[model samples]
Target chain A: MDRNEPLDRVKNRRDSALRALVSGVPYMTWLGVQFDRRGDELTAVLPFDQKLIGNPVLPAIHGGVTAAFLEMTAIVELSWSTMWEDLESGRISPDADVPDSLPRLPKTIDFTIDYLLSGLPRDVYARGRVVRSGRRYASVHVEAWQDNRSKLIAQATAHFLMPRG
Target chain B: MMVGADDAGRDEQARIAQQFIGAIPHARALGMQVEDIGAGKATISMPWAPHLVGDPRRNVIHGGVVSALMDTCCGAAVMAHPERPRSTATIDLRIDYMRAANPGQGITARAECYHITRSVAFLRAVAMDEDGEGPVASATGTFTVER
Candidate 1:
């Protein structure tokens, strides 16, 4: 059901839909996480906050906060991908109202993260790749970096139980 | 077990745990309080807050908050170990979410450093809500122990 609207209008709608979905989660808002959406893809941004410091000696970002950032990125990415499919099939309408139209994200079943380097006290960026998404389950691999994409601060693999359609 | 536990050792453990918690800003922001600490074991609790809610419709606490609590507890356990590791950092952590934490009830995490080598300590932790029969989540992690 690709409506005969201008291409740019449809693209704008998709982008806004993605942002609304991320903002619907209160914890995400509290963490000050923002999404950079281009078309349907996204890169999550976490701004530096003094209150996020875990080790006062090292002045490093809390490992737990990093995990939370990665996990949220994965869930939001998965939700956006599912919504894209639904949009193509006309299963749902473009979200005119924000929170009510936001999709319910999957619940994490398990997450394993390896810290390659200490999370420096700086703004961090993360992206999630959906390894596999099926009717009942999904798996994602996420990477977080500070200055460069090649130099990763942390990476993780997570499995989630998808919400029923 | 009580006969072998010395009063001085217990006092040192509790003091170390408090110091570690006090130094962390996120732990304080979340209002986490250390309940007890004894050689290689630490228990911490956090009160429920509206900002911590993840599933707004169901009013469930966020999974990230649970992981953060467990991570802090595990690190405290390592720092308060009888071996007296001067510093520690999480190298790898694996968390399994067993159930959603009920909102309004507080969450507490207990962690134990079950094993230690020269440079690494192994820890496990469980996060429980006030009314849950079983744990809400469990985590196992490895931390670098700097003597």
Candidate 2:
């Protein structure tokens, strides 16, 4: 963020950064997590996969995987907020000096989840809100929903030890 | 661990635990195995695999994998409860991760459904790595009991 780039370049850089962020985590790729990005915001998507179901009888996505999706969203969103600020401040330039690899994400301290309803056999989406983010700590709340946003499949709150900038 | 008075009852619970793991597609994907089970308790383990890694450079498995294992094990414990339990669903789970699981060490989780009411069961679980001296994560969860 040392200097402002063209708006188009900023958009492309943000998209690439998010993609790189997802690709950086092998488990996220294994879960087939994708992101729909708008500027600095992100909504994580977990595509339908039979391998994700924990209950064959109910044909529902595993509760653990739902938790994973929420955790991943919280993580990426948390990391992105700081990185985005760095990008805007021109502290690092992806075009010239930023390393090919992204910085390490914050370490998770604790995660608590509440399952509202069984996740149906369909695509699921999650959005993370950064309840608080500081130089050394962050707290995030994430919720996953299917067709009806009002009806959440699950929601989670996590506290992470943010990596020092 | 609560051991059933009769060996036959113990074996039957073990068989049910195995069948339970086999029935879940996600459990299969994780290569989960039934280690032990009895009335109101269950133990499950899963081996480490590349696909389960959260941080490849660090060789750390994903937290979600452990969460899933604990969740499944908790439900299994509820299913094996002495009461008229038929099926179960996770209502809420709180997991305090002490540390990341070792890279190549398999993880084992043991859960005990200590109490059950008309429609709810309470369980506590611990996840340990073969290489660790202490638990990798400890969890307490509430689940719905469907009799």
Candidate 3:
């Protein structure tokens, strides 16, 4: 079997696993999150929902909701990135029979969010980058924006406990 | 401050705090309830729900849910403060997850606005499930007070 064949197969399985993981979380599903992947980068879209608004006076999305969105994005991005790395390094076999379970979900150790601007009542987009990943830990940076990516509504940094394969 | 004016101010602040919580759609979605509020302090609770679970294998609530709870509690604490502004926005928040919240248990968050300046309020909060001694998470945050 070609080495690339297993990698390709694992990638296909990962997509289905990611979908299951997102649909399993009630809040994420309710947020109407849609994922777009380009290479190693992942973007999460949170469609506008009236129920997400925090301040009716300002008509702004809740800060807590924004934080949660960014945190989830980082976690998902990190999880997928790690899986890719594992496949490349032979840490996980492409033929492993664990079809019903995803790789161990990363546990959040700490997270910091900075609210740069009030989130408007529109679709919000978040992108996550894994700053560093090790056997036991991963650090991710994420930003949420509406209207314009340069004018981010919020930015966050988080550390997660990665599972050693 | 006159005693009568002080009491009235407190009452009005309390009303505003309640209204603020009620107006938040996300809080409503999470079933977050304001349990108590005092000058510079607030307590909020979230009932356990199946949808909030992050790891089904372990039956643990998602960490993001805990972060949202702490953030909301901290905001409420700022609003209940005697020196609270007419409005405020979260400037930043840092949360440390000590452990996963126990499954099938309601979580409560208690927060205090420890300091205030002309333009900012500083707050600290802790979230626990049943056990007040062992916290599921802790947070520190700052909010911008609109003058």
Candidate 4:
């Protein structure tokens, strides 16, 4: 096997694992989470639901719910890579019991949310990009938009501390 | 300076806080129930669920849930005072998860507005999954009151 072969296989398995993970979130399932990956970019599309409505007149999606959606999406994406390494090492399996210390990235060192436009009653999408990934820390940038307008509803740059095993 | 009280203003504060909860479904789904309010302070609680589990084996509530609970409680606590009419934005929230949220437990969020000066409100909350004894998480939140 080529040296890069294991890397490629792990990446592929990561994508599949992400899909299965998103399907498990009941709210994400209700909203229709669409996973789109091209290279290192990950996009999660969440359809709007009436229950997420925060304001009737302005029809803004509740901020907390929107934040939750973004946080979960980012965590799932990060988990894929970490879990793949564990699987390759035979430390964990999809069917096997998850260890007590399930992998954790550094706690969010910080996150800044800039609410540019309010999320309306239409499907919203969040695009996340790994700006930099290192041994002990990783930085991710995420943007939420609608209809390709890039309304820039919320942009978050989070620093995650990677756990040292 | 003498502190003044307005009965109507107090009633309006309660209504606004209630509307805030009514606006968010997940807050409702979490069963976040407000207990009472007094002098720029509020207390709220939410029930724990199997779905709330983060590390399923340990049955801990995800840290994000703890953050959200603290955020909600702090925002309400800040706005509970009659004098602050404008909306507030969370400038920053820092949480320290102390222990795992035991399975089959509910969380109570207790928040108090310690100071309100000019345009900033300082608040703190502890989300207890059992009673008020052992906390699942504790947080300090800062809010900027819109002028």
Candidate 5:
């Protein structure tokens, strides 16, 4: 029994679960969001599209669109992190009977967004960090950037209600 | 630029503002329509769509979509103000979800530009379904005058 082989299997299962979650929400797929997984970190990418532009004068991406992207990123990050934690703690089997619904979707309680700069018409990247997770709620901080990570286009914080398994 | 002070001029300004909002691609994609625009208030409506559902089990619209609707409504309210600048940009927005919206019901958001200074505009909005007594979400935000 190779240790690395088991880890690869788990990764494959997690990836498939993530795909189903994204495709389940039509808006997420419509925005052309793609997830990049690196060990414990997950980043969401929003490909540029002409239809995302809100202000044609400055040709900037819609502020609402950017906020929505950040919100979705936070939820996705929380879902994956929770799933891995459950698997490690033996709370849920990695090979659970459920195929389409491995991770439960969290409900948003509140969301706040700060627009530091206008989002240009280009690929945007976002990463969410779980600030804290309690029995009933989880708080996440997310940052979205286009050209550079340090120079963020927008930052958001959201609190979500975790569903009981 | 100083906004027109006459009735006709104000009407013309409202028309222009409506057109600008209509031209927003994302707004169009969301099926948003300008319900009304006055001095410092604007109302926008989003029709129900199956694709907007966030929770399949409950069939509730995503909170993000509601937030977007409120944000857009607030922006429109600011732009429709009699003392509006040439352009405006969202500085920050805070939204609180009171509860899940009813499935298959259109959401309407009404926003008011309560205060305006030299460089910033303050806005507050409430989103509701058919029942106006209970709000789906409420938002407060500030926009920078880009003139």
Candidate 6:
């Protein structure tokens, strides 16, 4: 019924799945990832440190870091949101929850990114929003912003393949 | 103080550069070599691979590989800096495909950090082949520097 209960259940039951999600990304570990979720939107922030500098004057960030951050956000969003049955099965009957018929996994089919503004030093944040969680697929719009809210560093749209009956 | 262009400095740089490029297996498989590396700048190159095809039918290399290459080289540039060794995470990256890479053409990436503050790091990289007039793809990214 409570949020912590589900997280605990996942931790106890799906350890391998969770570990795979995190361990698969060796580079993500290199960048020190911090994860968070609010409602349906999932976010991850990587704090800026000295080792990330490519040029002293320009100080470029790594593209791998961005790709990994987006992927991680997607993974968390998919894993945390349980379909209706999942919550009901766990003994939590909340009418607000979506139906149980919807599949849990979202297979990433394709993604496109556009670089609007250059990212500068400070905290880098990625917010992933579910565009459409359909029967066969799920799409998301992820926006990454840096220190300045007005300047968007990168934006990505990802399509995932959802399991179907 | 200005460091002279001595063999010692050059060799040290080469060693450090090798360490950065070694992180990516594909880059190693492609025989990537670092042309130069300084406090915050790096240039890495890998010869074109026929096997790096993206679409087998069209013989186009997958955009994923290009993205990976861009990420790897850009990360190397970031790690080459002689500052704190805090981990760096990629917050976001965008790659624009200027043109498809020529089949059998070697590829090279030049990446640099435009600006870095206490929390965020900014990066840009250009990938090109021998022709050099135009880039195959250009990337810009943000990274969070871990303390």
| Candidate 1 CAPRI category | medium
Q: Give TM-scores of chain A for all candidates.
A: 0.90, 0.90, 0.82, 0.69, 0.88, 0.64
Worst ten in a row by lDDT for model 5 chain B: B1-10
Instruction: Pull out the clashing pairs in model 4.
Output: A106-A161
Report lDDT (Cα) of residue B5, candidate 5.
36
TM-score of chain B of 2: 0.92
Per-residue lDDT of B1-147 in model 2, one digit per residue for the tens? 122334457777687668767878888989999888877888999998988888776888888888899998998888877774767899999998898888777899999998899999999999999976899999999999886
Q: Candidates' lDDT values, in order?
A: 0.85, 0.85, 0.80, 0.64, 0.83, 0.60
Cα lDDT tens digits, model 1, A100-151, are 6767779999999999988889999999999999999999999999998999
Per-residue accuracy of model 5 over B12-78 as CA lDDT, tens digit each:
6556656777788888888897777778788889998887777666677777788788888888887
- When just chain B is superposed on the true chain B, each candidate scores a TM-score of 0.90, 0.92, 0.87, 0.83, 0.89, 0.81
Q: In model 1, state the lDDT of residue B102.
A: 77
lDDT (Cα, tens digit) per residue for candidate 3, span B49-135: 877777767677778888888888887787677774666778999999998877678899999999999999999999999756699
Error of 6 at A139 (Å): 9.7
Error of 2 at B105 (Å): 1.6
Docking quality level of the chain pair in candidate 5: medium
**Per-residue lDDT for A90-131 in model 6, tens only?**
544222123332233344565556555545656788877777
Report the Cα RMSD per candidate: 3.2, 3.0, 3.8, 5.2, 2.7, 11.3
> How much lDDT does candidate 4 score?
0.64
For candidate 1, give the lDDT of residue A94: 47
DockQ of each model against the real complex? 0.77, 0.84, 0.70, 0.24, 0.75, 0.10
Off by over 4 Å in 6: A1-155, A158-165, B1-11, B23-26, B82-84
Model 5 alpha-carbon drift over 4 Å, by segment: A1-8, A88-100, B1-5, B9-15
Worst 10 residues of 4 chain A by lDDT: A93-102
Candidate 1 TM-score for chain A: 0.90
Q: Could you give the interface RMSD of each candidate, to one decimal?
A: 0.8, 0.8, 1.3, 3.7, 1.1, 8.3
* Model 6 chain B: ten consecutive residues of lowest lDDT: B1-10
